[model samples]
Target: MPKRLTLTEAQQQMLDLPAELTNEPIIITKDGQPVMAAMSYEHLTSLLETLEILSDTEFAEKLRESMAQADRGETISWEDAQKQLGQ
Candidate 1:
């Protein structure tokens, strides 16, 4: 988990954002109430991608089915995946 800090502290360390966010997020709180975060672009991008995937019901369903199939010992070769996707 990321470390938590007051918003003021984050402002003081604004110049070190890149290095500070290299490994974990910095959660900024206000009046002791959680408010914001300071994170790396890479982390933000990953979160956005996760949101996109989770928002796609069809894709999520397909992924769930794939997991179930794998658990059932069903498998497919990478060549077959390429063929199916016409790659």
Candidate 2:
């Protein structure tokens, strides 16, 4: 579960969170209602990238098709791929 903090507590302890805390966001609440989240820049960047991919209609369609193919066992083996690439 993520850490929760009130607005006042967030303001006071935002900078006190450990640097290694990256997996979960800090939930900021006002009057006990969640109003905001704080996460590492790296996590934000990753989320933005995922959103970008999801928003690209053509790419997302292709990705879905690829996943379906994978589910249907249409992929080649790693050795075959290496050989095809002359690696």
Q: In terms of lDDT, which candidate is strongest?
A: 1
What is the TM-score of candidate 2?
A: 0.79
**lDDT by residue for model 2 (1-87), tens:** 898989998788867765634787888899999999988888889999999999999999999999999999999999999999999
lDDT of 1 at 79: 100
Candidate 1 C-alpha lDDT tens digits along 11-87:
88789778989888888999998899888999999999999998999999999999999999899899999999999
How does each model score on TM-score?
Answer: 0.75, 0.79
Residue ranges of candidate 1 with Cα displaced over 4 Å = 76-87
Q: Candidate 1: lDDT of 84?
A: 98
lDDT of each: 0.90, 0.88
C-alpha lDDT of candidate 1 relative to the true structure: 0.90
> Candidate 1 deviates by what RMSD?
2.6
The 10-residue segment with the lowest total lDDT in model 2: 13-22
Query: Could you tell me the TM-score of candidate 1?
Result: 0.75
